[model samples]
Target: IISVGALAGMFTMMVTMIYSSSRLIYAIGRDGLLPRWFGHVKGHLPENALWTVVLIIAIMGGLVPLTQLVNLVNIGTLIAFALVSIGIIPLRRHQAFNNEGFKVPGYPVTPIISFLFCLLLMTQLSVETWIMSLIWFAFGLVIYFSYGIRHGHVAEKRIE
Candidate 1:
């Protein structure tokens, strides 16, 4: 539907995702949650990983429109956020858990704000976006429950 310099616009958007996502993955690696080698690159040379990310992005973008891709990512991020928020209430309350680092500026309020934000975003999604998001989330949920949930430290803590 978009006719004016669409390729350039989408490429610009893709760069944003690429940069933010790479930094996120690097952070996870630094925290020892993901593979340390991801953060072990020569001054942010997850350069190799970026190539893989670009290849996948090209494949996905080639197959789907930019709008759809954005919506799908939104859905995935929303679900991820929901799961993490759900964790805080129970997990962070434990006396044995480490309580280092910064706390929320306002107890309960910050989470409520975030929940509303996600809900607002979900509301903005189109029908096609909702469907695609459900499909992607379902696939990820299946894998997480089958593999990641069983192996994850957070999951193990929840079980204990």
Candidate 2:
């Protein structure tokens, strides 16, 4: 029963991750950071983006080792968390949002501590993971500069 429950939980988490990732892709595509076809809705779903995500996951599952994939996911999540933690400092300084939301208790200190912990955890990952991450980052930078920068919503807003 315990094993069954664990499997069920893992399955649920995987589904949730796939859904959220597809939504992120859809949002980026809608904002012109990717091809607009991914933003198209079919029966109120971002069908193209959803399928694309599924396809990518399937390919990765088939081609990549499970441990490597897990490491990549861990490092990616850590980096995102670290960036968000550090970003809060600037956002708070700039007063980007109104004071309606829950405030951080220690302000800069809390976020800085969180970012440092994330960095420390990231450093524990394998060297291969770091190499893979750098390659992926480079690919993203290329795409952003070559296409996304010109076609994205921010650029459109600037043109107006």
After the best TM-score superposition of candidate 2, give how far the Cα of residue 36 lies from its true spot, in angstroms.
0.7
- Cα lDDT of model 2 by residue, 1-160, tens digit: 9999999987997798799989999999999998898899999999999999999999999999989988988898899999999988877776546756768889889999999999999999999999998998999899989988888886533311
RMSD of 1: 5.6
Q: For residue 37, give model 1's deviation from the true position in Å.
A: 12
Give each model's whole-structure lDDT. Answer: 0.70, 0.90
CA shift of 101, model 1, Å = 2.2
Best by TM-score: 2
Output the lDDT of residue 83, model 2: 96
Deviation from native of the Cα of residue 140 in model 2, angstroms? 1.3
Q: Against the true structure, what is every candidate's RMSD?
A: 5.6, 2.7
**Candidate 2: misplaced stretches above 4 Å?**
1-9, 155-160
Q: How many clashes does the backbone of model 2 have?
A: 0
